[model samples]
Target: MDWHTLGSTPFLPPLYWRAALKRKITGSTLPEQGLRCRVRINPNDVAAYRKVCGFADSPILPATYPHILAFGLQMQLLTAKDFPFPLLGLVHLSNRIRIHRPLGGVSELTIGVQACNLQPHSKGATFDLLTTAEDSLGLLWEAESRMLCRGVKLEGEALDNPLPTPTQVSELTRWKAPADIGRRYARVSGDYNPIHLSALTAKLFGFPQAIAHGLWNKAHTLAALGEHLPAANIELHVEFNKPVRLPSEVTLYCSAPGSSGELLLKGTGDLQHMVGKWQPIA
Candidate 1:
């Protein structure tokens, strides 16, 4: 596969429009080309991300922070001319991140991203945007983000991996998701999906009001479990079940750190927003 080294991070807004206007390709295979960039981590940006995601101050990068570094490249891959799906209407179904070690005092990272694993879902087609972060030493972090394209059916049998069903559980803690969180996260993560921006834009896409980003909840969960996280070799998998509307109260249910367990985030009326788990990679 060919690797295209980006000189700088591609701006997201224009790519969305460009992908919307491009003619959709009709095939299963993604482009063989991939994207890579060398980024010097900005201390200010990292601090901003931690504050938004409720993480405590730390010299090491948060487990989910690499995704923010590679998001623009993922957007570029998804919006390429040969990509089979449109960029605007796709849904983030799930995310799986693996951290090999905590990165601190690392001035730069070589980030890479590519699209793969095209599969048929009952609702539509789904695919994975695989991303990696590395430095001169070796790979530090990697992730698989599954995305769904509604109304686009493929020929293969749809895979069935249902999200965990909501059950009554005691809340570990509650968090207030402010109305501007979507915009705040967007500023840090470069994901400006309209559904999460404002009630006005969200209503156009069938939501009553702006919703929080799925990964934001994932980040928050990790932040809450910060004490339990190991210094290296861990896996975090999260599935998006329902959208948490802006200006809403949400709760988290999870087993204490240093053990195996489920992590659930629910909004009002026991509406499940996310279900997930984390384990050490021994």
Candidate 2:
């Protein structure tokens, strides 16, 4: 889908604006309901996704990136002519994913997506979307993603505090990820978007080399938290500050005080920022 031209119109028509205002007061659920899509994981597709995401050649897929397929299905629903809302007006605010188990090889899975709650803000509007993916056995692989869309704004929010300030910088553990890591991750995750791996591919996107998947960094942060705290149920929030280049060492440092914990996962290279937050699972 050519996302570039999806919502070229700068202003919503007067009628559409009035409808949106009514939706803000009454709060409308996403128009698409009971929408479902399914796909069988293919080895070749997996290989491509792994290569793009920068994963090592292992039997199991990296815990993250399954959303690539899941979201693809959701996109189909969103872009349908009958679908509600204009795609271009949507802006990504935040996202969180939890992996129940490692996806090994190929398998069939089904994804269900629905829109919920249309919130109007001073800037424009916000829509809450939920997506769920599960295997044939009815076991949920992952659940719940919250996305925020900013309607129209003169200027986007500024980053006054771009740098993270951890109260305590603790000892860090380093991990050596292989160069072929991207290929392996892409294979399992089905996210062969081509920006994550290959220096040539990455150069087009202005990267020195293929960088590690954001989800992989998330997993590293979760692992670091597991080392210092119990992993029964932890709320993790990771902000993608910068990319971690391929074949590089990533150091994980964590600090926890009471129920709150802060984690800093940094790539030892030019792009030195990777930050995450952890709160005790409630």
**Candidate 1: where is the Cα deviation over 4 Å?**
20-27, 163-170
TM-score of each: 0.93, 0.55
TM-score of 1: 0.93
lDDT: which candidate is best? 1
The RMSD of every model to the true structure, in order and in angstroms, is 2.0, 10.1
Which candidate has the highest TM-score of all?
Answer: 1
lDDT of each: 0.85, 0.54
Per-residue C-alpha lDDT of model 1 across residues 149-202, encoded as one tens digit per residue: 877767889987865653543468888999999999999998888899999999
For candidate 1, the per-residue lDDT at 8 reads: 90
Residue range with the least summed lDDT across 10 consecutive positions in model 2:
1-10
Q: Write the per-residue lDDT of candidate 2 for residues 1-282, one digit (tens) a residue.
A: 112222111222432333333322222345635456666666676566555544455565544545665655555445554455554334344345544444554376666666665555554655555666677556445534434444433234423233364658685677766676666665554334355668788777567788776665665555444446432244455666666678787777778544467767676653545665655544
